[model samples]
Target: MPHIYAKYISKVLELPLKRDNFIVYDRFVNERAELFFVSQDGVDFALTLRRKNNRYLIKYDKATRPASTFILTKALSNLAIALECEVENSNLALVQKKESEVSPWLLKPNFFEKNPTFLDGKQAELEVGFGSGRHLSAIAQEFKEKIFFGIEIYKPAALQLLGRIERENMPNIFVVDFDARLFLQTLPSDSLDKIHIHFPVPWNDSPHRRVFVKKFIDEAFRVLKPNGTLELRSDDEVYFKDACGLILEYKTSNFHVFKNRQILVSSKYEDRWKKQGKDIYDLIITAVKKQNDDKIECNFDFENAMDISIAEQICSLPAIVFDGIVVRFEDAFKSESGAFIIKIILGSVDMPESKYIYTRDGISSFYPTKPLPIRDNMIAFKKLKEKLYGKSN
Candidate 1:
């Protein structure tokens, strides 16, 4: 025997009852209806109602199971109904919440052109992740002739800067909603006059694998003109040193280093970080393309020839390697200053390919050192001899 519970039957069911009440009237009962009830003493009973001619006939019967079965079934059925109602209500609320939360920075291009007086043909420059737009706004004002493009992903910050741009009627500035690295790939090569990336997210977990690694630098170098400048600013000293090392490895002639603490155009985040007493570092580097016939000369000894080969391969992969050492026929030659200076030319294999002599040191203190000529074909022979009978005897 099981416990019994009372049940009610309604003609029309309002699935979710109103806030305060949970009862139905007798008049609401309809034909061919059944109501089941169970008692706490483990008795089960059911009442069936049907229309005969004009009046309704009510028949009662006992359940084959027990009163406990009726009570458990009734509780489970009610729980199912409540859970369904809750799920539906929650889904509706979530949809409404999402609908109401629209970004304020969403705007059309025509919105920017509403006041067309600000459009000028200035040198176009772009800065990614312009947090508060303080540095961008300052640069826009300072270089009125240059069009400044800024991209930011943060909605509130973007909205704030959009309001400022509209209020000031700064026509030379354009804002894009995107990441800086992705936005850079879309621009035409050599189209930009300058690009400034100040205090960007330094993905510092791996020093060798920064956002501004060899690939990023190579892309920046490609997009820039023959002498366009790429400025990088950061507060991390370790990151700055790693960046300097990468730049040296790339071996560009037009490079300049700067101090972030000394620079006045500090970002809002930078200011906050400064308040925390973190020393900031900045490096400004420019990339210049080599001329068609420009020669790169360096000094190299046979002992360190492999290192020189790796460096050359890294700097310019398509370059041809030459073998031999440079020897001066005479100790000193006449100079334009009426002084006797050392005259030296590299003597190596006279192949048909264009050649550059590389040496480790210079003839005197002031003269530039030359690169030793070591042909690529001779590398295998050198390796074989070393393997057979140690280093060169």
Candidate 2:
């Protein structure tokens, strides 16, 4: 945990921190703090800004996943600048550092589509929400003939796992920082041998945020090979019951329920739960038949990109849609460096496409990285131009 002691100025400044890409959510769940999503270096983290005793403090405590001090430093720096607070006590300033080495084993969403087809004569296993990656690392070490893909939405936890993987030199383990449901949709039908969800976020109050929903269960079945098992171990009885209920709704017979089942590997939370005398429950779903992949045809390459000025004007429009496709202009930010950033949603309303559109020196493109060349995203991209310039290629 990193802390900064400074007398925060209640009066705000019109700082040039707009490029920091700060998007504030009223609040997430029952927390009194405001959830601030900060984007830096193409990666984003949720920072909580809470007011306590008339003192404003920034915290990086969004989910159960952990955040590093190095990351907190960046978040704090941005908050300090935006709030115009001078740091009186900061440990980050105590250490001067050079550019650190970037981890190689971790993959990004931009590289998902072009990922090489591994033909190493080994079955593939995927673990979603590999918090701290203890279970993932152990499974990878034990199963040398099997390829392991660990999907995590938290970048810092993923980065920490990448360093550990580098030190251990595990050859079969691959880390992907992305939404598991979306990533699972990209896999070939009947390709994976196993899918693991250990102590996943219960999201008890918010059922929609759960990973064990109908769509995810369907995707799991689609991506799992015949007789492949999708295992979920959770201590939350509500989550466990909900998961089993979802599987029952799918009308699958090859499912099993185990109570306090002993496994070769355990996560940090699992160990803690065991020590605390908390009973663990397991819901396993085995795929009995191969499922067909959903078809979506798209050509993402646009013949002609729109002009920046016209694109900016178009981005200012209200929600526009065509045949179930929708686009909404969220916000536009201008940096002191003379760059424009627009946050918008494109595609179907249920799962609209999202990416930062950038304009600088009259050139327009997606920032952080381009969207995965998926069919819906391509349609969304076309809608962006069509809505803005009144025509699209």
Candidate 3:
């Protein structure tokens, strides 16, 4: 039912909606404008429009803060109106903005079979949700040889990262314009060496619980090598703690927790959080693939006894007891007679009478009702047992 708005950007803004073949939308507090398109979902979005100088730019609001997806859509609509009027008719000189330089490898897959490389001579690292390419670019600069792949669904962020890659001339980095979770799922097991998730959108509401949870960690673990590191940083305390708990429960390794050293990376969100004096928590968890010995085996014998005892207790009640109660517990024979022989016995009688009326360790049929509709009483008894215990088959 819930869909991301960025996916439908091209179809929403037709020719009739575009003025001067350009549309503008706000990205935070930026007055920058870009060619725009509205998606089929009626969400106004900006695209990279190429000018004479081969420079691309997007226009949007400069002061809007990053909120939910709905807030983003509203800001785009506001930017589109301003872009239409500013570039209405005048043919102005195309001045190239330094940020307009696009990366050749942006939105393309960088890792390949022929050019296999290792991170620190051991593993490869992958990152998701590279916002402004600041942290990613820094990491690319530090670890030049590691296979670093990034995925961003938002066009403006993707374009910004592309420009940053070209500007920095970082060859080790590759970016994709798709959902990173889906991309990670396609990778073979033990393919990645490490994974870095820096401040992903924390879906705090209950309905959005599916967005950020153990599933992502499970996928990360599945793709990482036998013993790989998963480093995650977040200013949201609740999210950080929740993630830590999940890692402890699911990941089989020793976890190390630390406080972020107030390092101002390229992320605007992180910068804002730092300025607001928010405490950032960093959880670095090293997970190893659990061996067969680590698995816990459960005993079902106690559970089976508990089920029968519960049923017997319920059938002993006055409302449930009509004439008497019959309980059948079965165990299969290993001999030529392969059928299971169930011990059926009647309850609520004297010792000798109870033993005489019921079979000791075999199938015993008895009427628990006085009326001709004997099937109804049997159905009721079965239903009562099922509700109290569980399904037998």
> Model 2: residues >4 Å from true position, as ranges?
1-100, 119-121, 251-253, 288-291, 307-312, 320-326, 331-342, 347-354, 358-364, 375-379, 382-393
For residues 1-393, could you state the per-residue lDDT of candidate 3 as single tens digits? 011122112233333343343333211111222323233233333332223333323333121112123334333434434444233221122222323233446542223322334332544677778887778788778878676777777867876777677777887777776556545544556778878788877776652433346656766777778778787888988888888777668535667888865444547778888889888888877756634322222111112322323333443454433344343331211111211211123222111011111111233222111111122223333533464456622
TM-score for all models, in order of appearance: 0.44, 0.67, 0.45
| Count of backbone collisions within predicted model 1 | 28
**Model 2: lDDT of residue 152:** 90
TM-score of 1: 0.44
Q: Which candidate wins on TM-score?
A: 2
Runs of candidate 3 with Cα error greater than 4 angstroms are 1-104, 107-123, 207-211, 262-266, 290-393
What digit string (tens of lDDT, one per residue) describes model 2 on residues 1-393?
545555564544343235444433212222354444455443555555566665666656433112234555666676666667655565666424311233456655555467545423459999999999999999899988888999997866777787788788886888887677667766766778999999988989898777788767877887788889999999999889988877777554679999999999999989999999999999888875644556666554434444546545765677887775677776555544455556667765556656656665656666435666654567777776666556766
Q: Evaluate all candidate structures by whole-model CA lDDT and list the values in order.
A: 0.47, 0.68, 0.47
Error of 2 at 140 (Å): 1.2
Regarding TM-score, does 2 or 3 come out ahead? 2
Off-target runs (Cα >4 Å) in candidate 1 are: 1-122, 206-209, 290-393
Which is better, 2 or 3, measured by lDDT?
Answer: 2
Error of 1 at 162 (Å): 1.8
lDDT: which candidate is best?
A: 2
